[model samples]
Target: MVVGSMISQIELVLNELPESEKKVAEYILANAKEVMHMTIHDLATKAEASSAAVVRFCRSLGIDGFPALKIRLSAEVENTPHVGYFDVESNETVHSIIDKMLSNTILTFQNTASQLDAQSIEQAVSLLQQAEVIYVYGIGASFIIAEDAAQKWLRLGKNVYAISDRHLLAAAMATKSENAVFWGISYSGETREVIQLIKRAKEQGIKTISLTRPGNNKLSQLADVSLFTSRAPEAQLRSAATSSRFAQLFVLDIVFSAYASAQHDFTVEQLAKTRKMIEILYD
Candidate 1:
């Protein structure tokens, strides 16, 4: 299951969840689509959870209550295409493998787009635009996405930095002012290093932005502006991170493009200047 997806989140925290909540989570995962239409009491009976336990399960997911959970579950259930992540079979031909990879890429963008919250995105962009400097953080695969984010904004002349070193990041955060913003990118939203940096940034009154898979996570919870990407289920090949990367970049582009449009003349001039600089390097 995808790390940030609803079912996946329940599963990730299932082992640590209370016995009452575990029952509720198991029942929901087994009957995701059906749970959307089932009443709280009905689900409680099936899961052997008390009505209060059902409410707690919903809250654990960062949802308001049973009714809210149903609304969210309904959206995911109704909109999710029947096609999903499939593991490559041992004897599958190369052509079949290619087709599946391409399909998953297409579906990842579709799912991520459908799950995006417009208001949250607006706030994220606005914060970026207002910031005097933007510090992007990530580790491993997420660090690649953060670098891309920094590159995209740098071309537009935005003051952005993608810092991958934990020690250096902590040092930089120590001196950051309130005018600077911290953007943490982690698909699981639980990366220890990123979370620590965000905490430091906050102590200095720096606001934070987060790019994560849709659901509740500590990093996202700490962020002032939480942006989400599509969640892809896991496979033996671990294509979940691959598709999730695309979704993250997709969100980055949306925010970057919007920011560029707001300062079109400046961005155009900067693009021309950067192009000229590249040509000079070639000379």
Candidate 2:
């Protein structure tokens, strides 16, 4: 499925919707083809939800109205394949594992893209552009994302720090640049250490950005700008940072690509310089 597909958007935000709106989402997801041909009243009736609930559901997925929702759904149903995440079964074949992982990764990218807001991405890029120093922090699997982001910006000659130790990060915060940005990454959006660091950054008047899964969470609420990943469905295989990490990386890659594009000449020069330096060191 393509990025920002209507079906993917609905699925990504499904858990956050109210019960009334959820009924509409559930019905539409199950009967996507039928919903495309149905009117708002028809859908509401079939879903056992009110017409107002149908409208609210549409809005929740970032659609303006029922008609627009149906139009987008119609296009999505025609062009997008019906791909769903499959949990591993006992005694599964290697082929099955390969296919399932690929499907999960594709779903993660599409769903995360669906939840992303263009304006928020633009705002984040602007913050990264202006900041003299950027402090990236996360715990557990998210810390990997933090280091990945720091390495990307560092290649562009940006001052970036991704310290794994919370105590060490706290110490560095005291000596932050005057124009600094703090980015916290946590899939659940409630990691204690990340939250504490974000609070400390706020207290220091440093701009803050947060990346988390879809829905309201403390970290997102506390940040000046918030980025989100798709809420990956839990599975035994997924518990090991498979789909969730893919989603997080997808969002950050988009941000980094956008930032690099905004300064194409400089980015190319920096990349070439870094590559040459590495080659020379290898020699």
Candidate 3:
């Protein structure tokens, strides 16, 4: 956990915990304010779980230990409670829909930003910059993020390819340059195609980057550099993509902006050239 709301992180990993660990998570979720004052032993006894289970739960959240978890909970408990995703109702008003969606997006961005690791982001940028060719892959909604990422780097004159077809991407990976990079976007961190391609990329000795939601995941575990977005709970009509996608895009903007900032003059020149080219198309 970088610096955002700790409670949200707990919720994000709640479902992933084991039966005994889930008990600890449930207790904390219900009594976050009180948990701030209770000792680890107290919490373990109250949650009906052991001290080891408590420690395991904390580790699952990327927290070092029970004391750290309490400190984080105390800090966030005083703030306004975390506003989770709300499903759009059949009878929802237009105004209500707008408000709910806006709130969700804002929270998603805040949480995602808080959890970001500056060093990890820096490493990812360096890899992208050193890469001679970049291949980005995602499936369905994630494909949109992959394409957007390709365009951002393309404007900087990078040879970036965002191929939606898994077969084609695999073919490209086979002949990828030694200095190539692969970026994978899967919110769940478990998309089969993305995983398969990342494995291929690694086999070819290409540096790999993964964009996924916060928490332990297969994709992040496999990537050389891991970036995370906020977890968006399921929504009936929206399927959580509305906020999750925005969160993914938000992370992308941060990475792209950081990359651009590192090469200020080059980025400015390239952006100017691309802008002029777009203007020419309009003319």
- Which candidate wins on lDDT? 3
The residue pairs that clash in candidate 3, if any, are none
Ten-residue region with minimum lDDT total, candidate 3:
1-10
Model 2: runs farther than 4 Å from truth? 1-17, 59-64
Quick one: ranking by lDDT, best first?
3, 2, 1
* lDDT values, one for every candidate: 0.80, 0.87, 0.88
lDDT of 2 by residue, 145-197 (tens): 99999999999999999999988887787787479999999999999999999
Candidate 3 per-residue lDDT, tens place, 29-111, comes to: 99988899998999999999999999999877767899988888877778667776667888889999888888777778878
TM-score of each predicted structure versus truth: 0.78, 0.89, 0.94
lDDT of 1: 0.80
RMSD in Å for model 2 = 2.5
Model 1 misplacement above 4 A: 1-37, 57-81, 175-178, 279-283
